[model samples]
Target: MKIGYIRVSTAEQNTIRQEILLRDLGVDEIYIDKASGKSTDRPELKRMMEYVRYGDTVIVESISRFARNTKDLLELVDKLRQKEVEFVSKKEAIDTTTPTGVFMLTIFGAVAQLEREYILQRQNEGIAIAKSQGRYKGRKPIEHPDLKSTVVQWRAGEITATAAMKRLDMKPSTFYRKVKKF
Candidate 1:
């Protein structure tokens, strides 16, 4: 069986392109996760890992889509190898069925991780330059119509912090930070 794995960083991102590519490649099964590839904590990824059996081929669009770092990429491939599964990356033209392909996969994985780091470094530099030019500001503060009333209730112990946060539709960090500012 040819099993495809697809990932997108956020829920808003679309997986249609990857899906089409996998489908075109005649994949028997596909597991998709609309979550960052920064970690292997994704539900679909875990499920796919468990679902794959011996003699199966695991296919991905690219090494980066499978894992953001070389360590993770290598670890995942190693796990697949242990399970007697073959690994293939369409974009990188990598196939772990041969010695040369395994070597190329490692090289490509390292390159992908380096590329990601470079991108982050460039973005941070651009943000710094924009800040110095007074063109960059942090994210705008979130406002709620009943923020004051909710805070008051929270402070008076009328509601739990979690409840107050839920009512305000704010994350714990955001709720605490905003409450502190008040």
Candidate 2:
């Protein structure tokens, strides 16, 4: 079976292009993850890993969509190898079944990692420049009408932190961070 994996960094990003390409290539199954490729912790990725069998081929739109770093890329490919599964990256024309393909995979993985690093560096530089000009104020704080009351209840032990967070529709990190500011 030819299994396809498609990833986009955020939920808002579309996977249409990757899906179309994979479908055109006659992929038997596809797993799509609308999460950053910085880590292999995505739910869909985990499901796909468990679903694949020996002799199956895993295909991706590109190396970056599969992994953001060379280490992660190698580790993922190694895991696939252990299962006797092959890997193919469409854009890079890489096939793990060949020796030259393995060599090229390493080089391309390194280049992808370098590209991501450069992108981050450039983003940080842009943010710094904007900050110096007083144009980068960061994200606006989230406000809820019942936030104060919720915090008071939480502090007085009238409600659990989890309950307060749910009432405020806030995540644990956000709730704790906001509470710290009180």
Candidate 3:
């Protein structure tokens, strides 16, 4: 079986391009999510992982779509390898079916990880300087009228967290942060 996974950070984004590419590669199933790939709890991705079986091939448009960062990517790949599954990243020209793919993947993973770390380090430094200068006021709190209702529904088990998230149009992190301090 050939499976595909695609991710984007926002609801306004579309997965059609990646889908078309995966379809051309003969992917039989495609799992998609519109969450910031920075986290591991994406529903569709988790479902897809649960469904994969030995000998199945997982295809992704690129390394970032497959995982949020190198750590997650390597962890997922290791899991798939343990299950005797293969992973192919079309854009990166990586295919786990070959020895050279393994070597390239290691190099690529290291570089990608370094890049991410450097970006995060710079961001943290900037934020710290801004905060020290009293210029780092965060985003204004959401002012939606139904936020309370949504939180009630979510806490009451009347609606799934995902449903509440969509209704609020907030990322999981933002939603939870608001809920906790609201």
Candidate 4:
């Protein structure tokens, strides 16, 4: 079976392009995750790992979609290898069943990791410069209808944290952080 995997970093991003491309390639199934590739904790990624079998091929749009760092990429590929599964990256033209592909994958994964590190370094430098110039305001606070009232209710035990978070359309972490500010 040829299984496809697609991912985008944020909820706002669409996976349609990756899905269409994978479908065009005639994959038997496609799993998608709209989460950061920085971690392997994504639900669809876990599902894809459990769903593959020996001799199955996992196709991804690119190596970066599969993993953010070389360590993670190699670890994932090694896991697939142990399961006798072949990995194919469309953009990279890598088929892990070949020795040459394995070699190229290592180099590509290193390059990708380096690229990410450089991006982070540049972003930090830019933020520092902006801050020194007194123009670096972080993200603006979100406003929601009755947000303060609802938070007060939650804090007073009139509503469950879960319910409050749902009402605010926020994750637990964000909700708790907001609670602290209130």
Q: Which candidate is the best by TM-score?
A: 2
What lDDT does the true structure give each of the candidates? 0.96, 0.96, 0.87, 0.93
Number of clashing pairs per prediction, in order: 0, 0, 0, 0
**Per-model TM-score versus the true fold:** 0.95, 0.97, 0.70, 0.87
Which is better, 1 or 2, measured by lDDT?
A: 2
Candidate 3 off by > 4 Å: 124-136, 144-182
Better of 2 and 4 by TM-score: 2
The worst-scoring run of ten residues by lDDT in candidate 4 lies at 173-182
Task: Point out where model 4 deviates above 4 Å.
Answer: 144-148, 151-156, 180-182
Colliding residue pairs in candidate 4: none
- Model 1 weakest lDDT span, ten residues long: 173-182
Quote model 1's TM-score.
Answer: 0.95
> Where does candidate 1 clash, by residue pair?
none
Better of 1 and 2 by TM-score: 2
Q: Show pairs that collide, candidate 2.
A: none
Candidate 3, 182: how far from true, in Å? 11
- In the range 76-113, model 3's lDDT, one tens digit per residue, is 88888988899998888999889999778777877767
The residue-level lDDT of candidate 3 at 2 comes to 97
lDDT of 3: 0.87
User: Mind giving the per-residue lDDT tens digits that candidate 1 earns over 1-182?
Assistant: 99999999999999999999999999999999999888999999999999999999999999999999999999999999999999999999999999999999999999999999999999999999999999999898899999999999999999999999999999999999999877
